[model samples]
Target: MVRRIGLTGGIGSGKSTVAGLLVAQGAVLVDTDAIARSIAQAGGIAMPALEAAFGRSVIAADGGLDRAAMRQIVFADADAKRRLESVLHPLIGTETQRQAAAAGEDAVVVFDVPLLVESGRWRAIVDRVLVVDATEATQRKRVVARSGWTPEAVDAVIAQQAPRRLRRAAADAVIFNESMTLAELETEVRGLWKQWAAATTR
Candidate 1:
């Protein structure tokens, strides 16, 4: 069996970026977000369940899930968010596990999960957790710049995630992304990949 590496961080902390670098170094990247998107597409695996839960309003003009609208609703309503998760998380988990299992002994599967820390269900599936970390200020600046969100919006997202201290404590490895150039980040990721390859092969 292959090892499952859970890579995660709060919004805009560069978890995706690190996962990309890892993929470049031969790790099979299993993006939970991408799986969610696929499962939410029209006539997708999770679409019927989601529509049954939230009604047809969550569907977009193209018949896909209206991600923007769903984001707004979830941010405003805790119960709605939980309901959405209940409908989607299992699908994502199943696909992720399917991919990981198919990879088998040759795989170094990296789960790029944004909610790994908050999602208690993940700990059971992942063999190790790699946290991409950055300072709060750095996170705020990056998220705001990328998403055009207000400080309050960024703070709201940060607050909803597991705190940095707790995430760090849970980490089997940490990638500190503050002030690092892309080249430097790649080098660090390559080193980590080698480490993973060695550790998992043994």
Candidate 2:
């Protein structure tokens, strides 16, 4: 049987790095955030609904969703975020299902969902949940170094996500990312890949 793994982490926790390593090892990755961006792009399926709900102000000159403008509006207003999610979530879900179905029969599919813990619905669908974890300070420093975001801005985004404790509790496996070098991280991922491969074959 195919192993459906739900992989998640907070911003700057190196979840994407881990996902990339897994993909290199032949895992089929379904990244919901990427899917969300695709469906909100110019001429995407979600565009009509988003345009109807948020109006032209949230649509860019290129006919794509004005991501920066929408981000500001959604962060400022809870109702706006809900309205946006209502339009985008179903489309993302359908695309995710289609992608998973298209993967080879023996593939180990990983769903990279940033909000896996917050969403609550993924637990039932995935065989295991793997959370890439790091200290809050580590996350803050990484984000600042990589994205040039102010500490306060990083904190604001982290504040909006599920707390670290809740995410750790929800995880079936936790990959601690702080203090690890890239080589060490790759080794850890290799070990995980071997373990998951063994489990699936049995």
Measure candidate 1: CA RMSD: 2.1
What count of clashes does model 1 give? 0
Instruction: Supply the global lDDT for candidate 1.
Output: 0.86
TM-score of each: 0.90, 0.93
lDDT by residue (tens digit), candidate 2, 41-103: 999899999999999999999999998799879888999999998998889999999999999
Steric clash pairs (candidate 2): none
Taking the tens digit of each residue's C-alpha lDDT, what string does model 1 give over 1-202? 3377899998888988998888887788889899999989977888788888888889898788998788778989999999998998878878987887887766788888888888787788778899999999999999999989999888888888899998998898999999999999998888877776656655
Off by over 4 Å in 2: 199-202
True-vs-predicted CA distance for residue 16, candidate 1, Å:
1.0
TM-score result, candidate 1: 0.90
Q: Considering summed lDDT, which 10 consecutive residues are worst modelled in model 2?
A: 193-202
Candidate 2 global lDDT: 0.91
